[model samples]
Target: MSRIFVIRHSIFAQIVVWAIITAATITFGLWVLTNATIQRTNRQALERAVGVDLAGMVDIYASGDKDELAKRIGDRLALQQRDGDVAHYLLADAQGARIAGDLIRWPGLHAGTSESADIYIDGTNRAFARSTQLAPNLRLLVAHEYRDLGLLLRQVALVFLTGGVLAMLAVALGGWTAAHRLAGRLERINAAFRQPDDAALEELARGSAGHDEIDELASHSGNALARLKRLAASHRATSDHVAHEMRTPLMHLDNRLVKALAATPDAETAARIADARTEIRGIIRMLESLLDIAASEARRGDRHGLAPVDLSALAARLGELYADSAEESGHVLQLDIEPEVTIDGEEMQLTRLITNLLDNAFKFVPPGGTVRLKLRKGPRLVVSDDGPGIPEDQRESIFEKFSRGKSCFGTEGAGLGLALCRAIAERHHLEIALAPTDGGASFTVTPEFQR
Candidate 1:
């Protein structure tokens, strides 16, 4: 039963039902008023007819012609069948004995004033009676059939029912249409809130602006998404900061241990210590790079205060710095930079970004391979290497924090370099992309970024 109620009492159905009820109430009220007015008008007309008949009867009595008066009154009433309910009349004497007409006996007629009552003739036909004095010793009685008013009332009720039914149907249809329209809008709002993820939420928010309830719902959803994004960013930043800060002391300890191990005198013991120190140094370096990445990310907000920095000069410096290391490792480091190309950014961070890219390229390139750094006035920087290039699928994943391609599994460095480069590029609003190369990977950084 509860389930049935739920099915039947939908918003549209409820609206239609209420509308029908209201329409029925109005129709019934009008019907009652109409019937009362009609009955009142008919009653007034009947009263006037009775007065005229009484006057005529009194005139006949004054002329001492009772028989003629009775016949005339009966003929007059039979001809005037306007309602067909008008009472028949009879003349009676002071002793309550009927003198003429169809009345069998006069039953206790009142004096000095008119009296009305229901009467029956032959114990069958029902009628309404009114009696009045015709003279000092005579009276006139009139009767109308009770069924006449019943017939009039039945006709009025039939008309009222037909009209009321039609009006109720119209009202129900209109109300249902209005309620369904409102429900549809609410359903859309509910669907928007049911989005599965943030991207879906953002898309829904973009589509939900208008001068209605749906618009209000969309605006609220957008605000909630924005707050969630801010909270996630804040949490990430805090985690990075804590990890970076904790690594500094560990790095210092590892550096001290390395120096102590280098000065030991026992050959076998020294060899073992040296190996341990090397592992510690690797850990130290990884920690330092992690700290650098965190610090760079922290200072990202200050990128807007950057002045113009020369990319060519920066590239030349890196080339000179890495040239001897490349020579020792049997690889060539080349620079092909145009002079005076400038960009707005923190010079220190850009230098670090370029240095990391070059270091990464050199690590993958084999002996006799070339690592080229090119800076041009197209206001762009390009770094490329003739080495085993990153696989197509791994290129995008490599830019994420701690993500490394299969080729770099045994490499000495943590995989924060490219991630830091991406962070820096984002901070400076520069466009960074990997260009597809046949033999090796190439990367280009545009001076101005647009999203």
Candidate 2:
């Protein structure tokens, strides 16, 4: 019910409703004005007929006998009745005793007066009537029934009602069609924002030819996305340039430290030079990781040269490569790969992503602990270890670059491994999360399936 309310209150429904209301209101307004005009014209016609009849009867009473005058009035009434003119007449003494007419009694009224009212005659009917004292003891009343006018009014009402219904239907249909077109355009704009890729933005720009709110929004959004893409490319290029420029000097410094260590005669000075070389190597690795992170971020949603990558085969190869290292470290290594698991991605990036996760697992788990890799048919990849689990609070931040957990502060990892993995996972549209395990960390990667 709440969902229905939401839909009804939407712009499309509101447009349709307003159109129907406007059409109905216009239709009713015209109907009311026309009906009133027709009614007034009918009353005026009746008044004219009654006035002429009353004048003739007064002339007859002044010049002729009462009996003769009543006969003339009766004959005129009979002629109008036979012609279906809806007329009535009454002749009476001054004391109000009826002498002749269709009326049962004189409709009580002052002499020399004219008015429109509902009068009881053969039946109750609206009429324009007049009364006059033609002689000292003789009186006359003439009325014209407006029954046909009433019938005409009823017919007009019926026609107006039918027209109102048809108008409502026409307006509602037109309104809905227009609203549907507008809503479709808006939906296209929304879809562009969701995808936010070159192809989607181009599509949005192409659809924004119309001069409407949705079209304007599409135009604005496309511009914004293009700007963002350029900014991201510039940022990635800067990071790459910095990493490459620093690496050459850092490599030279490491080479000098190595030479100095070999030439030194003092054992303590040689050990200190070796420590400096080790720190230099760590710095080089950090620079390389930074370059990789930039590359991964820049490549997101990039479909160039993408192909179906066999995740199962890749995992198997990496498992074999890491097996010896895991065994030498006194840890049990396990692989449960589902056959023929494939995804559309860059094979090199996916390999790095998997390797980094596996390396992190191996680095954290203690001697005699277990590291297991699982690949399932859902294109789900899982790497788990029987090591200290990531703390609840640090699980989210653990994927951030250089954000190592407190427990692994002195561990071999510089914390770029998980961050790189996250970047690669986003590039492939995969959902990666740290699943809670009994006494260890469990990382699950579910690739977005192609339809």
Candidate 3:
């Protein structure tokens, strides 16, 4: 599959293969056209020469001069072995007997029927034969050896074939080199945009001096990156200001509720005040979750300030830390973490992501149930709990901000645990997905494949 992808999709391979195919197609077309033209012209010349020679033979036999049929026969037979003498002749009697000729037998010879044919006197030589009846008892055959012309044509074909191959090779080499350079430039542009940081955008802007289509694309990308940075910063600031402004007032309201509860000795009024305080805390939790979600979303794919984290050791430590809580809740905690698993990521954010997932699992899992955490060499992290799994119908929606699954209904969370997990995964160039399980909820985390 990877090989097919390279051949079918990679820019360098595509261009080289396409160029070679086009070059070979044109080369073969020229060879066929040129060969046909040469064959047609040569055939016409041979027919004309044969017609003239037969006429000259008949005129000699009828001239009332010395019967020169045998003399012309002798003339050709003597010259048959010469390099320039490409003619073959035979003077045969009416009794179907050859008097003189190189051919052993006639090849469907007749009078006034001229067409091109490959008449082989032996195995190696080829000629076109023409014959006529001059005297009632005398018949003559004239054949022109075009073997030299055929040899020349073969040589020409060899030249065309070799030239075509060489031309295709040259095109492939040149196209591959050109495509390689072009692809590298394109990849640099893509990599810069992937991170969308100030340094990457600055580098992209600096490299646009070439002024080609690629450089033009880089220039546009740099502009987009700048705009993105500005927008993200603005949105982050606005969210922070709103959260701070609202939180201060909410805290003051909570204090007033506390004072009202203290002042009112009536049990019913105190219950109402406590309920208000609970609602206030819930609102605060929701606001904090929203802020975290916003920040993670804005930082998606940002590699700035990331450090290598030992994921295996981290998972182990987290698992050991949760063991006490699991024992207190009468639930089992299992860890199957691979050793030395590591990735480049924000450690605090990643810790929050894992903690959220584990906390979610522990919240839903019943007493005496098992919650398992596994980490593999792929940096794949999976946390599963033996509890009522999420309904398939609500799985997709559960990843939306403030959207909760059927199993999470009335749960203490702000319904943003899974959403925040997804956001944090995206920030670290990872993926978070709900995996199907027989009788439990299972969440898997791994590197995301863009394609």
Candidate 4:
């Protein structure tokens, strides 16, 4: 694999690359060492054979006459040649004259010492000679063909190199497979982080079934997710309690404001009281939206009592309910409904989601503009309006609580409508997105039903 691709994907691929490089480096080093060792051993064995042969020739020269010594050397050389051996022998007299041997000239050597030298014979065939002195004036030389030892070492090196390459290939293949599997497992865990919930967190643990490093990481992640869920549940309960307690006081305040408005005779004081009542009502609505968000989020991953909602009929009914309001706003209401689109979801939340979209559409579209509501075969709900479309930059942020677009500054909404819609859609496991359109703002909610 290419380095850029591997680096972009995962750490495992880089590790595999390093492992193969290290293996190759070690193998090359071993081959060099082994080749040197074999060459040294072969040279040493050849030197020992030459030493023994020179000593015997010296003994024959001392114990026999010169002719007998020459005769003995000639016999030994002849016997080796007959056997097709590459061994050569040479013995010389005090005057450095040619003696009985295949080698023609006497090699230069120090007396009573032994050393190896390169010698050529029979028209430039090279041999390795071990030269030894038999006396102050007499010398002996024994040579073996250099090609034999060189060829043997080459064969040994070739075998070792071939085996090492095969082993490296095998190891690399195995490591690549292992790294690929590990990277896939890690990717799944990483994806789980994007939508952190009990089911997604549990999925990581379920996938990591083997007793490996990835499995251990999954185990730890599952525990952390469990702890986080517990903390969230506790916080939600506290918020609900606080909101509930505050609602009673808010209701009492609303009642007192109502009575004050009734008792007050001054018109200016009544206006102030009515303004306070409206502010209080807005606060109550904001609090209720917060509570709804918490409740919808808490219902995520809950499967008990979930039923298939008829989205087509629901959209048609909601369209009828909002049609007169659209007409009053001087905007045409259009419904593109398929007959029987159904999905598994909470019916109340689905109704609220549709209601919020219709409300948003009517509030935004200019007079004489058209609002289109679609329910299709995929159980998808799309709400689009022809108006100054939502800005590209604000489409995503508009779904956040109290996040209003620049064009919506003068609008009457508290800005939790879209936020509530999002929470409801997520609770139903739906895919919600703001789609790009030529002349309007569009939102689509598709049910990601478990099938």
Candidate 5:
């Protein structure tokens, strides 16, 4: 597996990314809502101030004192300047010209009408104001300038922007911390199974001290792997016991049959003894095949005691050894063994796998047939024989133990050849399948999930 795939596909990675996105979305939404609320409140406050001050101006106008109102405006302006406060005012005459205020000109043509208008200062409307006619010849206006409110809004925006950025950074840092820690621990668990050695499993054992879900998972997995190891050991011991108890008796019976054949000189009786010896030999071979199958099955998925084996050299050597037999049987044996086709495996078992397939090929293939042993760069091994092809019906069962229904030319076999071959292939994490062929049978061996 690629390291990139392992890291990027982690569940923690997805959670981390989603957390950061959600945090940013919420931060921006709250910032917009808060800014809008503050602006609304500030605008309402300015409107209230203008309304109250305008009402007071109406009281002054009702008193019917022109000098007093003018003096009040002058005093208010002086007080604002002294206190560094900003306010706009316009007390225009009925002729649409400034009379007693700092407004550069009358906002628009006016008379006894009382309404609202923009307070223009130096040719720019800077405030909203209300106007009223005071005794037909004078008008009063109290303006609410927006200069201070704008400065306050900008200050609020700067504070919000800075806080939002800090909040997002804090969220990202926390998410990254969580993702990195969780992903690193889970990756160690995955590595334990990929390589499956004691050193690899140490992380899982160490995780038992923690109280998180991953620790619980690690504890359970370690127990399960330990149990599997025990089961495999027991299975191997049983297989060895059966081989020992059965092979010795069978070998002794074969020796007795051989002696009987030698002592019995009568032609008819000697043939009978020889036939018995052949039966004993067949039984012994069957027992050995059964032992091989059991042993391979017991050790399936185990990587202990495995080492690099050169398939190219093994296949070439076997082909050379079988060359004379192919010539004697008048068959063509072709070897297309590419050099340096290597993989991690047990050399002895791989040898048995290749020889078993070749034995079956030689057994069923007639004279002048072609038997090919091919070893390719993918560590792909293929043994093909141009004999009578397997029937579609028998293809599924042929690899099963004692399935000799497809045994050609009445050949005698215990039918464990292909079954043993499959066991050996699976023991090494290789797949052996009867590949599609127009004639005869082709067995291909390749790694699972090759890419």
Candidate 6:
């Protein structure tokens, strides 16, 4: 039973149920109201009819012919009671004596000089009565029936029930149509997502757009597809660049090792061999950095490890280390850091991000240029270089894996520095922005701690 209900249940079902309930409530309410109104009006009409009959009875008794008056009253009662229109009749004297009528006595009567009283007669209770004065010594009473009013109300209730059922059917049909249309759109979107071919699925998802729920589903699907495509492209480009960059250094090292093995060398040649080995080690370090970036991107949310480190002190130290190099190169290196700005992260990765930015800046900046580093509040870091600035069009693309700007074409590095920075920032839920500078590039990093 539960499974059946689940299969049949939908928004349309709910709408139909609500409509039926509302219709039933309204129909029952109106039927009850109409019946009460009609019953009241019928009772009043019966009372007026009994009043007229009493007037006629008074005239008959006033004519000084008692037998004729009794006969006439009996005849009128027989005519009204024959077809079940009037149910019963009664007559009474001032002394509460039953003078004429089918019932021998009136039950629940109040003794007062009143003109009329409602009384139940025979087995069924459907009667009205009125009393009149023929003389001071004699009183006349008349009664009438009103059972047909109940039958009239029953017929009206039947009509209301029929109309309510029809209204419910109409509402149900409308709800079903609406739900079917909405569900069809959703089914199409789901099917598109399950398709094997990426391009075909994208086209199918795009084609669903119209002025309906299908359009909204299509829009969201398109956005998801675009993100997936971008991630895939970044991954491929990073892989290719890493392979090519590592291959060059490895080939040079291989050739140098071969030469070292073949030469009849003394101390100087041995020193040259050692230098080649160091250069190869530097290449290995750079390749490891690239691998770290790829790993970070692949598992951005996975917890690896963490340590507490002072970011501000680290930034100041990096500035000091680069200061002599900047002076010898005729550029100024300035640092402004707030103390005790500590955070929990992989210290090595953070240091690599800072080192990459500084190295890129130094490589691009000419003589008389400046590199500025600022860290504050444990959450914000700014690095600005007075070098050739990135063009507006290239700024957005420069952070993509292996995407190089004009100034970086001849630089001694694969273009993974900015990409790695971006991946690290994302892993920490940080915002990184590249801003335009007067004569160079400025980058701002806002960590999640600040938010």
**Best of the candidates, lDDT:** 3
Q: Tell me the tens digit of each residue's lDDT in model 3 across 1-451.
A: 8879766878678778889999999999998999888988877788778778767876877874334666866776776676763777776777657776666666667643433355776766777778877656667788887646668778889999999999998998899888888988888788877677688788787675678888888878887888888998999999999999999999999999988877866998888889889999999988998999999998888887799999988899899999999999899999999999999998888899999999989888878889999999878999999898787787888788877654433555668988999999999999998888898889999999721
- Estimate, for each residue in 98-148, the C-alpha lDDT of model 2 and write its tens digit: 899877787778764544455766565566678887777777788877756
Q: What tens-digit string does per-residue lDDT give for candidate 4 at 1-451?
A: 6867757666887777778888888888898888888778766776667667667777887798667877887787667753344678777766667777877776665435577776677858676787766667677777776545666777877887898888789778988998888878887777665456678788766645486877888777777877777888898889988998998899899999898877865999898888899988999989999889888877675665579888888888888988898788788999999998998878888899999888787777778889999888876789998888888788769889997653333556788989999898888778677888898889889766421
Off by over 4 Å in 5: 14-207
lDDT per model vs. reference = 0.74, 0.82, 0.83, 0.79, 0.79, 0.71
lDDT tens per residue, model 6, 326-355: 899888898988888887667777887788
Cα TM-score of candidate 5: 0.66
Residue 322 lDDT in model 5? Answer: 95
The 10-residue segment with the lowest total lDDT in model 1: 188-197
lDDT of candidate 5 over 1-451, digit per residue (tens)? 6977965777776787777788778877877898788867766776777778877877886785877777777777877863333566678777767767666666663435667655555656366677777767788777766545567667877887787778778877898898888777777777666556665565576675667898888867766666666687787788788777888887888788778777867998888878887887788889888988988887776677789998888888999999999999898999999999998899999999999899889888888899999889887889999999788898898899998843456766888999999899888998898999989989999986562
lDDT of 1 by residue, 1-451 (tens): 9968964867677768878998999999998899889877776676666667666667776786677777877677668666555467777888877777667777455745787666786678766677887767777887665545677788889998999999998887777777777666665455544432566556656654455766666667666755755675686677667666666666676677667776876788778767777776667666667666765665554443689888788889888999999999898988888999888778988988898898888888888899999888856788899888988788878788777754443554567778888778766777678887888889888755431
Candidates 5 and 6: which is better by lDDT? 5
Candidate 6, residue 386: the lDDT equals 77
> What C-alpha root-mean-square deviation, in Å, does candidate 6 show against the real structure?
14.8
Which scores better on lDDT, 3 or 5? 3
Which has the higher TM-score value, candidate number 3 or candidate number 5?
3
Sort by lDDT, best first.
3, 2, 5, 4, 1, 6
